[model samples]
Target: MDYLEYDDYTPGNETENINITTEVTFRGSKSSLSHVLVAFNIIILVVGLGGNSLVIWICGWKMKRTVTTTWYTSLAISDFLFCAFLPLEVFYMITSHWPFGLFLCKLTSSALFLNMYSNVFLLVLISADRCVMIYFPVWSHNHRTVRKALGGIALVWFLSALLTLPSLIFRQTTAHGLVTQCFTSYAGHSTHKAVVVTRFVCGFLIPFLVIVFCSSTLCVKLRRLTIKSSKPYKVMAALILSFFFCWVPYHSFVLLESDVKNHSLDLLQTGLKVGATLAAANSFVSPILYVFIGNDFKQVLKRSLTSRMEEAMAEDLRTIGLSRSKSKSVEMI
Candidate 1:
């Protein structure tokens, strides 16, 4: 993406509004840091691909189509697709060139944002679903079907694709002497600001507030209720914390990138690159979180992988089911 340069420069003075330019100087020298970043991305790509593929297989086919599995399956599919497109990015980072042409460049970049938006949307849905199950168990037990869950997933995908259109539009390959560099070219400074702010608000801020609210409510309710399994709560906490740590740096650096003139361009670039790799690492880290928290190592070893995954996913459902029964019986008293 393009960086902004403010025209009004007064040392130690604050200006309310100022004119800005979309002038950017591209940096070329790949340091040892770039090598390290590339290595990390490659690891993420390999592990994320394998782990997300397993989740997709287990949640999509091995288990019965339920609301929880439907959500998990869609999440896995998003991450899997994100991982599938990482090779193009890894190649570009390694070579400092984009030979894949314009379409693939746009597609690959958009895929990352698509994953970001869709994953956050799914997390919000899962949290809200849990809240409804806990507070209004009877309503959820009767109404929360796989079909309805699929519909919500469809809406999330549609909105994610719509949000991703900007990346496709702004992303292009420009010949930089001997190299073709793929980058975003915003039409104006306001456009750049708009895109960055929108991503922060929509992709990060809103979902974060919703998830936090739902999770807090669920925790308080579950503590007082008759639910026995804490695995679901652990899984939810891990997922939220993982998403927070992984993406917060990326978004933070991205916001810092908006005021690129005040900060050292080289430092911002390096920070952004590192932050992005951390964000990509979330794809693999999620599956590991799910499996690791799902059950003990002994149980995982004793049971088939398929059964283990099924059991992990079903924990929330079983907990919710028991809560529903308990709530109903309490009414009879």
Candidate 2:
């Protein structure tokens, strides 16, 4: 669930001069923003976490025998985990204090960034899978094994973790009088700027570019298909739209932040703050828009959980209830 953002120690970053002159208000560093952000983020977090959790439970429980569902289930688990920690942001937004000390401050903030990276990485992987399957159908027919995709996804997670290592290296709690700010601690001022630049490129710019490229190409190719419409294409379209919806704001904010840095625009500070809060909300958007609403995600989720008990009586008839002796038995059966 942690989106994999770049590490904060990439070099040439303007960490020293990065401090705002009364731009960011906290309960000292982020206080006033917290009030609004806390309410919004907390609400989003509740919805996203709850929804994604259900998706994960269902996918893992009901579709455990399948491959794509397994990847999606893992994705849900990651995203939901991030949602679970959002209350911390909400709590800090209300009280404006990072009482958890340096360790937690760094870990929590870094975790959020990591989740961001993970989310994007997962999306990119999904897009790639779609493209590969379409372009090489015959090959995919032979090689598109659930086990193979799962292994690939596992590799994505590992690389995402590696890429986010910089966050853990740089995140820290900086207390200035009444406010305790959570931020990255690059080795040098230049390094901070480098970190930000790298983040803009690797996390936002590159991933966005890849998503757009892959999805667009896939869309064009799919459109040309003379074959009848299948359920998978619809799923592919939903996935792309979901990726676009959740991530646009976050990346846009990065660009806006770059532009707004030390500028004296009309509604400068307030605008930047508002934009940042919007960016944060991007973290929760996809879970609401995509995973919850797409295809039969809801039906699948319901079937995964309480459906078992309701249908337990009919267990003898058949697991799917469609026909007897269709699919083999599954799970704790």
Candidate 3:
């Protein structure tokens, strides 16, 4: 989610110093585009906050804790925190300045990546969990406890935080004429390439592969077993598709950014701008998909939001013979 920004390069480097003016000019010209981005983010902030907060309330507080609720609540919390910080980004985008101190600059940058990593990791986990449940219902019914799910959630957050360190470390703010700009200051080109590549591999590539494998296998299993209740699979598939569509462009732009010499700078900057906004849109889009897609809107209106959410998160495993004891079937399989 990093922008095309002005770096706080080392002092007294004439060549690098001169580039600052050019960078500022390039950004200033994009002021109108920044306003568009700010508007989009403002909408995301409002919708994301309202949607994720309701999810957190329903899944975290109202519902009895289950493995599914635990995962949903964790995801909601991550999105909520990410949405909570959009005002900072909105302010920066509007003014084209970093009036906030260095701490907030680094914190806000790291927060965006933190949300990305955590969201992707959780999606992978959810897909994998469903794959296992469908394939081994009896075993999963016995073994898929909330405690283990919580442990997994903890591990995901830890790894996400670890991966976000680059943003925290490299982000810097410095005064450029009258405006203070916030940007990343990598040690060298090699370091920049390394960071971008690492982010792609860990944040996007690996999760993508895992999610694809799990969803594909889940589909195959559903077909082989001839199970009619595909509610869980539908939810998981939508999640996979949404994540894929939203994030692929951003990652593509990021990889292209590493080899800036070969790519058009305007293309890269515009791509990142659009892609980042799209990725941020996913935060709010998920609540709609997760909470509203499966339920009948009219019925949901009649019922409480809690009942609707619970129904949305509830798996129709009974139709697939998963809710019953199938030890003999498990043994035969």
- Measured by TM-score, how close is model 3 to the native structure? 0.82
How many clashing residue pairs appear in each of the predictions shown?
0, 28, 0
lDDT (10s digit) by residue, model 1, range 217-299 = 89899878988677877877898899999999989988987765577656766677778888888888878877888553225
Residue-by-residue lDDT tens digits, candidate 3, 1-333: 585442433444533432232222124335688668777889999999998887777667666688887987898899899898888877777677878898988888887789989999999899989988988899999899999999999999999999999999888888869888777777666777788899889999989998888888887777778765566567668877887898889889888866665666668778888889888888887777767553422233346666777776665655445635576677778
* Top lDDT prediction, candidate number: 1
Evaluate candidate 2 by giving its C-alpha RMSD to the native, one decimal. 9.2
Candidate 1 vs. true structure, TM-score: 0.82
**Candidate 3: regions farther than 4 A off:** 6-32, 226-228, 296-302, 305-333
Per-prediction TM-score to the true structure, in the order listed: 0.82, 0.75, 0.82
- After superposition on all CA atoms, how large is the RMSD of candidate 1? 14.1
Whole-model lDDT values for every prediction: 0.78, 0.61, 0.77
Clashing pairs in 1: none
